[model samples]
Target: MDDVHAVRKPRDSWWTVFLVDPVACRLTLLVADRTAITPNGLTGVSMALGVTAAISFALGQLAAGAALFYLSFMVDCTDGKIARLKGTGTPFGLWVDYMGDRIRVICCAAGLASGQYAVTGDVAYILLGAGVTVLDLFRYVNAPQMKRVREVVRENRAQREPAGEHLARQDPAGENRVPCDPGPAEVAAVLNEAAALIREASAQPHPGAHRVLRLYRRIGRFLGRHRVRPHLMSGIEFHAAVFVAAPLLGSWALLPVSTGAGALLLLNEIFLIYVLWLSTRTAPASPIPQRLPV
Candidate 1:
């Protein structure tokens, strides 16, 4: 089992050559050892390095800062690849990954804001901070609600255990039941399907679903394109393009009004984050068209 969880492998993207993918190169070096680090350990280390990078940037070191920050991004992707290669993905591990990423992102934003203040000593720093603070505050305030939503998801699927809560061994009779059993893709699929079923069943008697369906029709009264937007293909790409690239671009180079532009763009991301959060919270799950697992 340990060997299975620690096996080295490649993915469909398959950029194993060090020269081809420098990011993957750095990560592959970490995995080249006789043993591999656990996913959560990788995430934690990544967060630490990312935080250091952000702090350095905030302190106004550009070149070294960029290299470290980029390394952070490499580690972020590497952990996911390691999980995929070894099939060691666990709910607890994923939750840790998500939390670590969120913290790193927030720190980066804060670092940028601080850097602006340190560099310019202008009132614009206050504005930038305000925008970032708003987004951070919103996420902080909503985290509990999100936790509850996840819990609801678990309970809806008849999970007595908390979502992402790792279970310790429970002995029945003379036999050991299990110890820290964490499943991968198939387990996730089953849980998601079960949750979907619960959602479908729960909504069966609700008249609100019908009214919501009608509203969707009314909203789509105009013609539309079914093609996915350049902005929406993947969440990471969308978020990175909007939040990181747009804001930090001007700050990194001596471009015309780059820092100013980054500040304004940061504000837009705060608004975007709020909208996406609300959309997820209020989204009505349509009548599931698929059959339930028997």
Candidate 2:
């Protein structure tokens, strides 16, 4: 619906919000709404364009590859927006979108590396391509699982907390609260539970999470008044910016830019793996309560 697009700003990367969404995705969505085209169809188009972009890069057409890559991403963004607008989103569509994203990244990276290899005759470019693909794939897979776990924890907490208590805290001004959504207390509980799950899952005691949580709290405090989510480094945004700039730098530079992106992704993957390891660890034995005198 138009409502979805009109309300709060999309909680996506800033690049998406400013660079792609307003003009590109919106225009594409407009055309799609008027035509018989479906979201899945758009997704397929995106995939095809991405493959072509990759091939173009492999053949040493950096500018064409970059243009096609950007267009592909724009169409990819359009499919989801159009689906949400038309109320035509499906589980199958979601799956296709996810897989398409992965495949696109793989193709693009491989093409860039292949092109670089052609230029320099280095086999490391091939390995660099594999690293990029693996890093992006891990991000796609792990981030969602972590998010889902947090959601489950929040839902559990919301069911446990009293409605009046939530109303008193989050809706103290008597504003109408959305009945379907959880409140602040519930969200806080969900975060706590997610942290606990991470601690439990770790093989050894880890203080890194604790330090990160403190920083997270500080950012939360700063953003609480603005009601805006904090922006952080994201692989999606990183790669987007890289690809958008790579063509301008010429073919030889694309390799170094992509390799740098891959390195960043690897670091991010490490952080994610640490958190995931904590989430899967067994919780310590519960302490027994001592008897109190009557």
lDDT for each candidate structure: 0.46, 0.63
Model number with the top TM-score = 2
Per-residue accuracy of model 2 over 1-294 as CA lDDT, tens digit each: 355465323345555666777666556646655787888999999999999999987987888888899889988888876787677889999889988988888898889778878988988878877777777776666665565555443344445556754233433342222111121112233334435544344566557665664465566455443443333346666567456676668756666776676666566556545544443342332233222222
State in Å the error of residue 32, model 1: 5.7
The pairs that clash in candidate 2 are 198-278, 198-279, 200-281, 201-278, 201-280, 201-281, 202-278
Residue 127 error for model 1, in Å? 3.0
> Taking the tens digit of each residue's C-alpha lDDT, what string does model 1 give over 1-294?
334224323211111222124555445455734456877778888899779867875886655555665566667667766777667789898788977777776676667667767888765655654555454455445444444444444343333334543222111231211111121111212222222332344545334433433333333222112211111112233224323444455553422333444444444344334433433343334333323222
Worst 10 residues of 2 by lDDT: 176-185
Model 2's alpha-carbon lDDT is 0.63
The Cα RMSD in angstroms, rounded to one decimal, for candidate 1 relative to the true structure is 12.6
Give lDDT for model 1: 0.46
